[model samples]
Target: MTNILIADDDIHVLNLIDIHLTEQGYKVFKAYNGIEALEILNKELCSLAVVDVMMPFMDGYTLTKEIRNLFNIPVILLTAKNQIEDKERGFHAGTDDYLVKPFEPKELSFRIKALLRRYDNNPDEYIVRIGNTIINKKSYEVKVGKRTILLPLKEFELLYFLMSKPMQVFSRDHLIDQIWGLDYEGDERTVDVHIKRLRERFSKLTDHFQIKTVRGVGYSLEVNRE
Candidate 1:
């Protein structure tokens, strides 16, 4: 059975999400704040996490960062702040998805399912090589020559998807649909952000591969053959 940790300061919101997620056949763990959430995470293994932005001790942004640094689980942030900046912040903190407050329970459920599906790393589809860079899907590890580099979840997924089809132009919408799922309601700029992060992370590695923008279209991974 898949377990999920839901952390929120509001008792009502925590219970609401707990009931809905439990009814969906998930083993749910509830926490009243980020500290408790982290404590629970330390003791139990969960497949995913639903975290609230505002909390005592540690905020969702901080908790998500810690989770990303220490665990290989998908995180979805729930918050009342619906601004694009706030959403971007959540993504930058390594959250796989974001849901605003008062959001439909069904939408949250769909988002959770989508994230879990996308992040289900299979050992069979493990290694991908593009020039000197190697992507280990199963381990979520990236290697450039002898050095290893770590990327946030979203950035790593975006890189893997693009490298899977080198030189193929993928429109932002297509990338978002394939990577973030068709149910994602966020702006297309989210794709841009992830792409930018990928570029920055790999810039120092090698010049053999580059992510090129398509101006009016989208972007593509272009590999320079020797």
Candidate 2:
């Protein structure tokens, strides 16, 4: 079973997330503050993390920075602040995703699963042959034939997820839910941002191997079927 650490100052929030995640087959760990979160991080291998932005001792951004330096574990920041700058800072700080307050428990569960799916599938060689591109999961490196490309973590996650389910059309909401999380509180444009990044990266692989932007729909990874 995957292990998840959920850190929030609100006891009610912690309990709610714990129950929801536990029912979904994850080993849930709770921390009321950043200090406790660090303690949990020191002791175990967590597949994913859910952190609140505000708390005593250390904030979510600080803890995320520390965790990023130490591990490639995927993180979702929970914040009451829904500002664009906060989202940008969370991403810049190396959080894999973010969720604002007033989110649904089911949404939280989906995001956790999506992040876990991305993290747990990573292997040491750090290279994935998706279509004509060879993705280096570790260095965030991508190689299409002889060209080398670097990708942001979110872009990498999006590309990896789409490639994992080639030809499947993921609706914007479903894609967001699959990649971001159910409780992921953000505009759908977040998915668009990463998708654009993925397209730019794959453009190096030849436009033939690309993510199709389904009009009035969502996106799909469609390798040349001809």
Candidate 3:
């Protein structure tokens, strides 16, 4: 079983997340504060850590930095503040994912799963398969059955990224930064255009998966697992 560590000051929030994660078959190690959290970490090899920004003795950012320097595991920072600066700081602190307070437990579960998959996979080489669709990073081709489809460079990169995380939603800004360079000066709608092209190309060609827009959020590739 995969072990996860959840560190937070609030007992209610920690227990709530623990119950949900335990129900999902994860062995959870919980702590009421950052100091206690590190104590648990020293003994247990957790697959991932869910940490709250506010904590006694040490904060989430500091704990995240310690984890990054000491262990090779994914970290998700939870904070009540949804401001851009806070998010930037979290990212700078080496968090693999971020969640605002009052978030749905189900959403946190999904983020955890996605980050696990991401960290487990080799960044430079790996093939992602969902349903009948296969994204081959080595060849830069998407194979749907026997028919091999080659997408445009950006389109292919975009498809590969979305397929990589499967059901996880990625905002337009995040997508742009990953697929394109941080120095990319183009409009954010570049992501939209690529998504549209990928959808149009694959819609009639396969029933394996879909690039779904999440309205206010962004997009996720929903796999037809059944």
| Winning model by TM-score | 1
Per lDDT, what order, best first?
Answer: 3, 1, 2
Expressed as tens digits, the lDDT of each residue in 1-226 for candidate 3 is 9999999999999899999999999999999887787677656768899999999988999988876644557899999999999999999999999999999999999999998888778563367665567778888888887889888899989998777665678899999899898999998899999999999999998886899999999998875633
lDDT at 102 for candidate 3?
A: 93
The TM-scores, one per candidate, come to 0.57, 0.55, 0.54
Winner by TM-score between candidate 3 and candidate 1: 1
Give candidate 3 misplaced runs (Cα > 4 Å): 123-226
User: Residue by residue across 13-77, what tens digits does model 1's lDDT show?
Assistant: 98888889889999999998888987787566688999999999999999998776545678999
Off by over 4 Å in 2: 123-226
lDDT, each prediction:
0.85, 0.79, 0.85
lDDT of 2 at 113: 78
**Candidate 2 C-alpha lDDT tens digits along 69-144:** 5445789999999999999999988899889998999888888778777766758325545435666666777677
Model 1: residues with Cα > 4 Å off, grouped in runs: 121-226
Ranking by TM-score: 1, 2, 3
Please count the clashing residue pairs in each candidate, in the order shown: 0, 4, 0
